[model samples]
Target: MTKERVLRFGRAQHLIGVAGLPAAPAPTGSVGIIVLNAGMVYRVGPFRLHVEITRRLNACGYPTLRFDLSTLGDSGASNESQSRAQQIRADVADAMSLLASHAGCTRFVLLGLCSGAQNAHIVAVDEPRVAGAIFLDGYAYRTLGFHLRHYLPRLHSAALWHRFISRKLQAAANQRGDDVFAVSFPPRDQVRRELTDMLDRGLRLHFIYSGGVTRYFNHPRQFRECFGRLASRPEISACQFEGTDHTYALQVDRQRLLQEVEGWLQRNFPTSDGSTA
Candidate 1:
């Protein structure tokens, strides 16, 4: 059995979230899992993915919290002036503190998708309490292989040529405003350095990509290509679901992702008694 409750936390109690707790005590070494908002979406995640993930982890004896960022969803805006990135990191830290006080969780694992994944990476790299992170459609850089795989197949399609010409024409027009929901990728070298630092500190990292970002990441091996020798680290694992959309819209795709997450947790953070808590 599992239990859940509403939580309001953060500096001014401006954050809102749901916490899923196991019926029995969590495993001796289980880490609390924090699920962040996907883009501008609420804590429920796209198609209630966050809710599903929280329940599944709860069943395995892990406490999970799914919450909105400072200005997104039900959370109130922050009064302090800070960059969006700073606000995100502060919000994540506040979440960890909340879980620590509420569930006695000293360690954490972050789970996110798309923009949420980027936030997870930012927080996990700097926060010492983060034991692991699961990133879906996270930071990806174009490689020689990516260019070949992306353009070669489309060369024969007349539609591609038409679209290319259309894009060129559109490029001459005035630029649009920045999209608040769109993710801004940091430098690849910076990300690679942070990833190396996290791995050196024994953090477990999982990178999963869907077909939605096929333009940037197509195959599983592309992870290796993007990060170079760092991809060879034993602490890192990755998967590519070729047909799955960015949000795992299909039921079957969602199920597959859930199963993968469960398996990774079991393999990396099993209970002391050799059973799921």
Candidate 2:
């Protein structure tokens, strides 16, 4: 049976997350890793699709935690404007510490979409718990671009969104992470520099973009070129999917995106080694 359990929980004023335990138990003596979503969405993007893989990873003896960084999901404050990229990194750091101290997961594995993944690299290098990482369809941090997902219907299932917001809002009175996306702002090259520096450290990474969303990047070719700039280091792995956009249109289909990251994760982990690092 596919099941999800909340281990220890915390918040970011807009974002909040639970140390997660999948239905299947992890193998004995193996540690767990956490998955952080991009843009403060729910823990159901590429993170959800690969639940089974992670379950198997855990069953084979590695546990995993999938959660929201801050204003993206249930992690932080709503009106608080927590989307500042810096804050998101802070939230991820908090989650990593929580995972290591409370949940006993010293080894952290992180994956982020677009800006989330970009932020993941920052956190991975800043904190030692992160051993491996995956950047699902990441792009170079830009100052301006068509943020379709901001207005489009790509944020995963909407059925429970209202309810979740209602409940979380009552508890905190205001949210933190949502505001990051509420207002669009100019990009800071320094953030890009920080992220580039992190990539140089050889963080195991996988960048996957869907085909459908390829047009947004002026077609996949240009997207890849810009992506290459962000990941300018030699030790990174990247790919493009056939039918996804900024939010990853078919990301959850049959583990579409997860398959790409499998190699990177394994290479980082002596166990999940694929064609990476």
Candidate 3:
């Protein structure tokens, strides 16, 4: 059995959160999980993925917390004038402290999607308490293979050819102007360095990409390409759902996503006392 409860605690501000706990007391050293927001969608996650994940994890004897950031969902705004990155790190740290005080959990795993994934990565790099992290539809950089596969198929489509020509002419017309299509992603070298340091510290990382990000990540090998040899480290795992959308909107896709994550957690962070049967 699993029990759900609302939690409100923060330093210098109040944030809203929900905790899922097993009916029986968790064993000593049991790891808890924290799910971050995906953009502004609140802590419920896209399609309520966070809710399902927390409940399932609790049933398996691992406590879980899904919380809303300041001004998002049920959380109130903070008066601190900290940068977004600083505020996220502080909020996550506060969540970890709350779990430690309330549940006796010292170790934690962080999970997130999209922008939340970026924050998870940032925190995991600096926070030693994070034992594992799962990033869904997170950072991605284009590789040569992606470009080839992406444009090769479009070559056969007349509509694509017309659009391409129009875009080329538009680019020529705006050669001296700033690029309007530019998008922001973390620098590749910095991400690689941080991933390397995290892995060296024995951190477990799992990355899952969906078809929703095909424009940036089209194949399973792109992660390796972007991160270089670090992607092949045994502590790191990557998966690509070429058919599923970012949110796993389809019932079957969502189930598959859940199974993949649960299997990963069981393998990497097994129960210390074999209590999760």
Candidate 4:
């Protein structure tokens, strides 16, 4: 059986969270898991994905916590003057501390989607207590293969051609300066170095991308292409659900995502009896 409790705690500011506790005993060295907020969405996650994931992980004998980071969900805002990055890092640390104090869990796995994925990566780098991290639709950089794969299929579509021409004509009429879409992706080399360092520290990393970020990512190999040799590291795993949207809007997509993450967790952090951790 899985039990859930809603609670609040913080160091600088209070944050709301739900703790998912498993009736079954967790394995020795079992680490707790924490799910972070995705963008402005509450701790429940897009379509309550976090809630579902936490329940499932709890059933698998891993206690889980899903929480809002000050001002996102039911939490109050922080009065601190820290930068956004600093605030998120501190908030994650607090969550870890709370889980440790309450659950006797010193190690943790952090999970996030989109902007939350960015925060998870940052925290995994700074916090040694983070044993693993699952990044959903996280940092992505385009590569030559991505460009080819992106444009090749569209080239055969008359609608795409018409839309392309229409967009160009609109751009010409507006006399707009260099048409650059404002998208942010982390620096490739910097992320590679960070991943290398984390892997060296024995951090298990899992990356999942969806079709929703096609503007930046399209194929599975794009991640490997962006990070070069680091992608081949045994500790690193990547998956692309090209048919699914960013939030796994469809129920089937959501289930597939849950299965993928559960399997990854089992493989990377399995219990002594060979069950999911």
Candidate 5:
């Protein structure tokens, strides 16, 4: 059994979080896990992904915290004079500090989805205490392979071509912007450099993509194609669940994701000397 408690921390107690404590003491060198808010979603994550993840990790003798960034979910607004990115980084750092004090954790593993995943990457790069990061539906960029795979099939279908042409004409007539969420990723070069640095420092990074972002990422090997030799490094790993959307809306998809996460943690962040929890 695991115990969970609400925590209020950060400057002026602006941050709110729920920490899942393991029934037993965490093993030596165990890394605490933090689940950040997903996009504009609350700390519980899309469909309560954060809550489920925290419970699983806690059951495995790992302390897990699911927290809201300042001004999101149940957390209050921050008075810090900083950019949004800086504020997020500071919020995560504060979460780590709170986990350290409450659970005696020295190392940490950060996990997030979509926008939250991007935040995890940023924090992992600068925060030395972060031993690993799991990014779900994270940064992606188009490659030549992506173009070939994405467009080649449609080329043979006359109906597809007509629809495409019609859409193009409609778009030109409307002159309207795309109905997409305004999410920005650092330049590919910057991401490559940062990932290279993280790998050099022995940081464990896992990038998981879902079918929801197929426009930017499609195949399993797309990550390697985007980063070249940097992706082949031992510490870096990636996978894609083609059947699932960005949010894992279906119960089956969520279960599959949970299993994958549990397996990754067991393989990479074992609880004991030779066995995992």
Candidate 6:
């Protein structure tokens, strides 16, 4: 594992990372993958998620760079007043640029969790170098609404997210007014449509889902439909894993999950799949 305190856009200090590649020649020049971590600021729990996943991915013979999006972790924007959209997009572009400058990673395979996935989709849509993307327990699918749709029952039994949402809704009501919450953000459903429509051409997308989520929120069928709508030559797919919740990487089924991603790497970035490029 190699950690670099590099300067991304705006001279923000970033703990850029590369972990889990064996002590062998790792595809000289360009890198095979760039793994993204989601929502680091929202909760510290995601820290464990990013770290563990990077460890597993590296152990599985995949070298990865787990970066902090602007203002979220290490990379702070040029001006503090950067919008979320600008910050997120800049962070991603900075990552891709870093890959080229440091590792000779001409193109990157983007992987992000939840909001990170959303940002990755944003980056991939514009940059053609992004070959593929993996949404790990992602929430921005047009099929599923924003944030906690997968937690609703009609899709999966009211397991985790429903209760979490209920509490959040109550908290919002307690703190502010209906109009405030309603108008404060974009409807989650819109996020999906906008995201899919923004996809890059021929970008192979892999949605790895577990948490028993179905149509009511973010179901497998819904994801497929959304992907179908957005991608002209989209290689989109959905798969299910049993007994897992939204934060699948934390208590996420480790063995099977790793295999799923490993297989995905083989099909997508084969040279990074414990084999010679």
Worst 10 residues of 2 by lDDT: 142-151
Worst lDDT 10-window in candidate 1: 172-181
Question: What Cα-based lDDT does every candidate model obtain?
Answer: 0.87, 0.53, 0.84, 0.85, 0.86, 0.56
RMSD to the hidden true structure, all candidates: 2.9, 10.4, 4.5, 4.0, 2.9, 6.1
Q: Can you write out model 1's per-residue Cα lDDT over 70-111, one digit (the tens) per residue? A: 979999977889898789889989998887776667789999
Candidate 6 clashes between residue pairs 3 or more apart in a chain or in different chains: 20-58, 30-104, 30-105, 31-105, 142-192, 248-252
Task: Please report the TM-score between candidate 1 and the true structure.
Answer: 0.90
- Where's the lowest-lDDT run of ten residues in candidate 3? 177-186
Model 2, 184-252: lDDT tens digits are: 323545645555655666455556665533334423344334444664455565666654545544537
Question: Candidate 5, residues 70-96: lDDT per residue as tens digits?
Answer: 999999988978998789888988998
What is candidate 6's lDDT per residue for 1-277, written digit by digit as tens?
4443334432454434443343443564334566665555431225365556556655544555666665556554456566777766666676666656554556577877655666676677667677778876655334435234443443565655676678679867787442211112246566556455434355577877666333233445555455455533436666766567555544537567767877876766666544532
- RMSD in angstroms between candidate 3 and the native structure over all alpha carbons: 4.5
| Model 1 CA deviation exceeding 4 Å by range | 157-181
Poorly placed runs, candidate 5 (over 4 Å): 158-181
- Tens digits of per-residue lDDT for model 3 on 1-277? 7778898988965799998877766567667899999877888888888898888888778888899977778998778999988888888999988877767788899998887788899899899899989999877789898899889989789998897789679869989855422336778888888989989988899999988778789899888888888887899989998889878888898888888888888888888765451
> Which candidate number has the best TM-score?
5
Span of ten consecutive residues with least summed lDDT in model 5: 174-183
Assess the local accuracy of residue 53 in candidate 5 as a C-alpha lDDT between 0 and 100. Answer: 83
Which structure is stronger by lDDT: 3 or 4?
4
Off by more than 4 A, model 4:
25-28, 159-183
Q: Candidate 2 regions off by >4 Å?
A: 1-4, 11-32, 46-60, 76-83, 141-192, 216-224, 227-233, 245-252, 272-277
Tell me the deviation in Å of residue 93 in model 5.
1.2
Worst 10 residues of 4 by lDDT: 176-185
Per-residue alpha-carbon lDDT of candidate 4 for residues 85-104, written as tens digits (9 for 90 to 100)? 88888888889887776666
